[model samples]
Target: MTLTFDGTVLVPVADPDDGERTAAALAPLLTDRSTAVLVNVVEKAGGAPDKASVEQREEYAEEIFERARGPLEATDAAVETEIRYGTDVVDEIFAEARDRDVDAVVFTAREGSRFAELLTGSVARRLVKEAAVPVVALPHGDD
Candidate 1:
């Protein structure tokens, strides 16, 4: 199916750099009527000690959103930020996508070695394979 940027989109960002790169890649595609929802999934450790405090993660999420906002803001697309919490990152993204009824889920894939991806279970692969909405994988800045 053809992808259009007139409707709302769910954008999952990993970190500040990822956020900036993803937004840069996606910015050119967005229209004046588009709404870009920047989301950072704070993965919760179920029944285990947390790696970071919730406040720390939320602050980091805000930092991500701030970096991501600039590129999209240069365009006419409306930018919004959401900090999501869940044990499963991909699942949380999908849930937010469904909840928002977004036209698409847009992101730039994070770089990693094949072995690293295997060990970490690539979120990019899971997002494309299991997405309920249209999933757009934009090229990274170097690409």
Candidate 2:
């Protein structure tokens, strides 16, 4: 099916590079009426100790959003950023999408070894399989 970017879209970014790549891939598809909500999910440790401080994670999210904004802002689409916290990354992304009433979840799949994906449970795979809204996996700019 053809993917159209007419309504609000939830974009889950992993890092600064991911933010840039995903935005670059999505930019061409967006129009003046489009709304791109860039989201960075900071995984919490639940009951366990956290890997990084919440403040640090939020700062990192800001950096990611900054990188992502360049390409998206160059397009006619409006850009907004959000920081979400959860124990599961995929769940957080879906929650954000549902909460914002996004038309779709757009992202570029990160490069990784199949073994690593299997061990960690690939977020990309889960997103496509379980999303309540449409999930669009855009090809990376380098791909």
Candidate 3:
């Protein structure tokens, strides 16, 4: 059976290490026919990304996506990707999963504590609690 997953962020420093490890862990769990997606959220309009900043983000995203292509392809799984932004991250992630009718979302767990996440207002435990679909939060690490 084919399974679907939601991958968040394509930032070099924030991704690779964590996401790659999580994907590795999930590799065995998915079937050969499974289809996984690397979904990256780019704020449709985040106040402003200035020309240089926009270019920089795109460059970084390109690098991350290129690197991701290899591992996902090796799993004998089809890969899908997307980048969008205009809503709260958690809300958008859950919405995408439901819309895709995927098996679950595979994202990384915040490496910090609840208080830290709350203070940062970044995606983390809130996703697990609020996501309408099944959400798999992988620990942050390289191994």
The estimated TM-scores of all candidates read 0.96, 0.96, 0.71
Could you give candidate 1's per-residue lDDT for residues 26-80 as a string of tens digits? 9988889999999999999998988999999999999999999988878988999
Local accuracy of candidate 2 as per-residue lDDT tens digits, 95-133: 999899999999999999999998999999999999889
Clashes of each: 0, 0, 1
User: Per-residue alpha-carbon lDDT of model 3 for 3-109, expressed as tens digits?
Assistant: 43333222211355554655565554545567776666544545654334656666665665666665555666666765545446666676677667777777666
**After superposition, which runs of candidate 1 have C-alpha atoms over 4 Å from their true positions?**
1-4
Per-model lDDT:
0.93, 0.92, 0.58
RMSD values, in order shown: 1.6, 1.3, 4.8
TM-score computed on alpha carbons, candidate 1: 0.96
Instruction: State the lDDT at 8 in candidate 2.
Output: 98
Compute the lDDT of residue 43 as modeled in candidate 3.
Answer: 47
Candidate 3 or 2, higher lDDT: 2
Give the distance in Å from residue 28's predicted Cα in candidate 1 to where it truly belongs. 0.7
Q: Give Cα distance to truth, residue 25, candidate 1, Å.
A: 0.4
